[model samples]
Each structure stands twice: as structure tokens, then as C-alpha cells.
Target: MSANFKVLTEDSQFQSELSEAGGRLVVADFTSARCGPCQRIAPLFEEMANKFPTAVFLKIDVNQCTSAAASQGVSATPTFIFYRNKTKLDTLQGADPETLEARIRQHYGDGEGEEIEDSGVPGHIDLIPMINKAGCECLNESDDHPFIQALTSAGGYLESDTDEQLILYLSFNQAVKLHSMKVKGPAENGPKDMKLFINQPHTIDFDSAESANAVQEIALTAKDLEGELIPLKYVKLQNVMNLTVFVKNNQNDSETTQISYIQIIGSPVQTTKMSDFKRVTGKKGESH
Candidate 1:
């Protein structure tokens, strides 16, 4: 329960990590030490812990922590449960590594899947509410192509009817350090070049994007468009308030462009919790 991956022997430790602060995603594996499938999937599960550095990975032995397993409705060995902000998102039973990995990437990003030491996983804070058109022009800007749709729904997307480029302005509710980003869409019509301008003016246009000083410009490949986590230069994205992404063009010289999903992974510059607040008294001298 202390490391990125941990064994939960008691119910107390299990509950504590489940409710840990800062809106983290927790993945719990319920297994019996004696089960053959449980034994088989152990290494793959551990590899997932390393792959998802930002998620809390827990392996609970049903025999050791019976209360925890029963409370979570785990009746079978090698069951997996995903939780974020104390709410259950999804669950998987048995030791299917492909399904498990896909589920993890669905909630998190698809970073380099290699198993490495946990430097840490970036927080996946939903930023759809903070988006603004700024200076964007799209031929199809109706509800069908709502910009916010691309940020959340994996199946939903925003498309440009007039041209191949689309611009979006993201102003976070709080400052965040961007670690990585994932883009998902059709292969041929997917983005090829993306330019990021940090804390820039909202009046940025297609022409302005060419002249404006770019913090980073990424030459995206097919792998990136298919939901791979493209890690950004970490140092350049510290304390970011507003970000601008200018999609230059698509892989194919298509007249229209499509983006099914866009995900940002980062941590807030300062996280304020309601539990940390206390009422202040104005009339201390007159109060009884």
C-alpha cells in the first residue's frame, strides 16, 4: 500500500488508499494466493503498475483480506476494479492482460508501455469545462462538432468541414504541469503537425500560429494518433494556465479533419480541498 504497487493484508489500509486525496485513479486486483490464474497474471499486473505511474495499483489477497474483497463484490479470483474520486469506473474479471491494459489506457494515457521505475504518473484532470473557442473557425461547429466533445467521449469528436486545421484554447481552472497527451482518431484524417503555444493571446489564428512563438511543435505520427501517450518536454509546461493547440494538417491531404479524443495528463499547481477549509470568526472579543 506504500509503493506504486502494494499488497493489502488488512481492510484498514485498503479503505485508506481508496479515499486518498487529490483525485487519483485506483486499480485494485482481487486474487487468492493459491489460484493458478492469479499466480499467472501477477507479473503482468506488476508490469501495469510500472506502466501507469500515476495510478494506485493494489493487489488484495481474498483470503488475507476477506472483508475488503466481499465488500467490493469480488466473488472470483483475479478480479480487477477501477476507481477514481471514490467512484467506481469499471471492472474486469479473470487475467486478460489485453483487456486490462486497454481499460487502464482508457482512463489514463498510453505512455511508453515499458515497465520502468515509478517516477510517478501524471494526474488526469478533466479540463473540458475550461475550453473556449478563442479565435477558432470551423465549418461544422454545431452540437455534432462541439469542441468539448473531443476532450471527453472516446467515440465523440470534433471535425472541421472547411479546412484541415482546427484551433482550440484551453484555460485550466488551476495551473497544471502537463506531462503527456493522447490523440485518437481516424488514421488518414488524423492530425500530423501540432503546435502548442502556452499562455498566449486568445486571438491566435491560423496565420498567427505560424508567426507566434511556439513553446513546442510536435510532428505526430500514426502511433500518436492511435492513442499513444506523447510525452511533452516536462520543463516547458510547468505552471501552465492557458494552452493553445494548432493542428496544422492531417496525415493525408484531406479537405476535412477529425479528432475523436484528446486527453491531457498533469497535476494541478495547487490543489485546494473543501476538507482543508475552516470558518474564521470576525468578532472574537464579543463572542461567548
Candidate 2:
């Protein structure tokens, strides 16, 4: 085992580490000393631990923790399991270095080594500041738990009034290029089916939202409701002044949809300001 990563010999240790990881990604390498491929990939796995410092890396010996291996269904040595908030995101059975690295980058992203692929856009940033709070509204929401509570306040949550459906309307102070969004909620009552509409002239009701064409529609996964950043269609959400989110239902067919937190990530579109325009008098009325 590498000195850089912690080795888990007991199931309790594994559970403890996972609990402490919270929302951070946890990569567990189940290996045995007798496995030839495990030895080959140990060095590279250690290097990844150093490279992605933000993620928690662990080495679990299958022989030492047989119960833990059985629980995770790790029949083969050198099995890599990816987890976040105690939920398994992905799993690999082989010792392929490229594939392992690709899987890590797929979820957590490469820290500063990450390359910006979107042309003309600098990078993604928190677009919550650009939201026009006064214009924001949520239909079928409880009076005590308004939509703004989910966005603006910490430890605040939004609850539906009567049904599982919720229509959230948000207008931005300026045009923005939306990258992605995060919606956090309970596992059972979280949003399941979602439709996103951009640049709508006014707030859309549930009927119009269901009938109208949406920019992007997605079904939220278990990990997504646990605070994973749900990506948007980059090409479609380029110049958005407003966004409408329609929550069609909950995961467990619950009566009310509950949303605890909402985060919008994007960059504000750059446009010429009035201050940038210089006053020209046509050379002292020469043209007149």
C-alpha cells in the first residue's frame, strides 16, 4: 500500500471515511497482494491521489476486509469504486490507468489542470448575483417556504403547497451563459422529472410549461438530488435572460416536492455599456 493513501482493513473504517467524505468524491481501490494487476496500477493510483487532492483516496485490501468486499460486491481484485455522499457513482473492475483517470476526471474534474473548452466564454462562475430576486417566483409553493428561501438563505428549504409539481421562474438582471445547476433535496421527495425553459416572456404555469417546448429536459438521478451539478446544453443556453424550471414529480410519488438548495453556475454575457460610448458632436456641427 502507498503511504499517500489510507488502507482500510476493517469495515468500520471504510464506513467512517465515507461518512466524513460528505459530498466529496471518494475513490476506493479494492486490492490484494497476490493480484498482479493490482501491483502494476498501485503506483499510478497513488499518483492520482496526489494529483486530485480534493478527492478522498483509499486502498482496501480484500483479504483483510472480506466483509466489506462482499458488501460492495467486489468479486475481483483491483476493483475501483467511485462514491459521493455514500452513493456509488461508478465502478471499474480492471486496472486500466487511462480509464481510471478518465472516470475520476468525469466526476470531480482536474483541479487547475482542467482546460476551458467553451469558446468566447472565459469560465463558469456563480450566477446567483445576477438573479433578479424580485421577479423570482414559484407556483404551488407553501407560503412559509417561498422559492427565494431555497436560493438566498442558508439552511432554508422550499415545500410545495398541494401537489408534487412546482414551477420556478427566475429572471436575471443581465444576459448570462448558463453552464449548469444544482438542486439539493431529500432522497424521497426530491425532484425527479424536470424541464428547463429559457428567455420566457413571463412566468409559465404548470399547464403551459408542460405543453411548451423546453430548452433542456432531464430526469434527476439519485446523485443529482444529492447535490451533483446537473449540466445544461451549452449550445442551447447561450444568451438567457430568464429561466423557468418545471418540476413534474418527486422521486417516490410524494405529495409535495421539497428543494433545500439551488445553485446556478454560469458567466454573465459581456455587452457594451453606455459609459463605453464616447459623445461625438460631429466636429462642432460641421456635418449639420
Candidate 3:
């Protein structure tokens, strides 16, 4: 089911019906027109409204709904609240699209489908946790970067594909640890050989320190998604440049194989094991 909800500046139904919307999967945005944060989250809230039509979604302008804000304990503008069966499942303050989607997936459930065998599908990493969909389109070709609550929400999967290439524009201050890349072989449904690179200023030349996290190269045979991380003691990962990968299909066919499309996810997801580095059965585009 799909839905579109338009919450006006002054609506009396919210207070009386808030509890009615409880436990039914609701994403409420407490916003104000004057506040920049409120406006920024508006499109994202509505986008989610469309994606999860089965869920109740609405927005309350803090400036107009003073009573509602007070009743809901909204002390700030653009505070996102998720209610499942009228019970508060999650909350985000000063959040972005990606932040909202992540929260939704955490309390609601991952939109990133089930695990498959070595199908060669790639995985994604949401480098910026604060922005729900910051890395949302690392390598996505799902109808362009239109704002979808699932894509812009707190913790929604950005893009889902078997062959993908990701490019991330980062802020050194916020990124903590982001070494998980999604990739897969043609036969393997999971992700495979994943790589990361950084672009920094030439004055800050860093070399021969892999542990320092210049960048990380990771590979996987199966989906162990969460475990010990590949060490960054010698890599030196401060100044970033670019990140790229070739999730090619080397399958033994008479014709060549070239990727037609790609999808990059925003957050770190675990749907498969393998990676994007290994050779594929479809070596169609070997020349490229």
C-alpha cells in the first residue's frame, strides 16, 4: 500500500488521534517554517510517507502547533519521532535524510531484502551516520536521486545491486569507521571484493602507514557482515581522493559483459557474504 499525507500548519486531528496512530508504524516530524532544519527534513518526511504508505506519516509545524509540540515534548525543531503501535520506537534530533532512514530501518525493519547465495550483488556503507542517505547513492541507478524517505530516512538502504561503483564526498570530522563495501560475483548474490580510497591535499602527503587508515581494502567470501575489522594501522586514511571498484562478470560466454546499471546504498548493510573484487563468470567486458 502507498500513501501521501499533507499535514497543514493548523490541524486539530493530531492531538486527539496521535494515540490512534500509535503502533501502526508512524513517522512524525515536528517542524517549523522559520527553522532551516525543519524545511530540510520536510521533503524527506514526505518521501518516506510515499515509500511506506502502509505506515502513518505526518508533520507538525512547531510554530503552528505549540500545543502539539508541548504535548509531545518537542523541545526543538525538526525532531523526528517514530511510533510503532503508539509506542515510541525511536527518536532523532537534528537529523538528515539518511539519519531518519536508518532509524526507520532499525525500528521498522531493513528494506534491503533477504540474503542470497554468491549472486555477485554489491553491498553499501553509509559513511556518515548522521546523514541517513549520505552515501545513499554510492552506486545507485534507482530512478535518480529523488528524495525518498527510505533513501533519505534515518537508516534506509541507499542502493541495492550486484555490480556497483561508489564515490563519496566526506567530511573528515564525522566519518568514524567505514570499510564495508558491497559487491558480488555473477553467480554469487552477496557482495565481494570491496575497496576504499581517500583524496587529500598534496601538502599532507601520507604513505606507508596502512594502520593509519589512508584507505582500506576488504574482501569477503561469505556474509559475516559484523565481525573484526581489517586493521588500519599502516594505511593512513585522512586525506581522501577517490574510491572505485569493478564488479565485473567474467562468465565464460561468447559475448562480452558490460554493466548496464548500478545501485549504491547509504548505510552499511549485510545481505550477503562475498565481495566485488573476485573474477566473475561473465567476462563480457574484459577489454574495458
Q: Which candidate has the top score in lDDT?
A: 2
Instruction: Give a tens-digit lDDT track for model 2, residues 13-104.
Output: 98889767765667999888888889899889988988777778999887787666666766677888876555555678788999999878
**Each prediction's TM-score versus the true structure:** 0.53, 0.52, 0.36
Worst 10 residues of 1 by lDDT: 279-288
Tens digit of per-residue lDDT, candidate 1, span 46-110: 88887778778998887787667666766677888876555454578877899899777755532
- lDDT minimum window of 10 residues, candidate 3: 113-122
lDDT at 150, model 1: 73
Clashing pairs in 2: none
Give the residue spans of candidate 3 off by over 4 A.
Answer: 1-4, 110-288
Candidate 1 global lDDT: 0.69
Order of candidate numbers by lDDT, starting with the best: 2, 1, 3
Q: Tens-digit lDDT track for model 3 on 75-179?
A: 666777765433344567784788787666654433333211121222323332223333322333234322232222233232333333323333222332233
* Clash total of candidate 2: 0
Off by over 4 Å in 1: 1-11, 14-143, 271-288
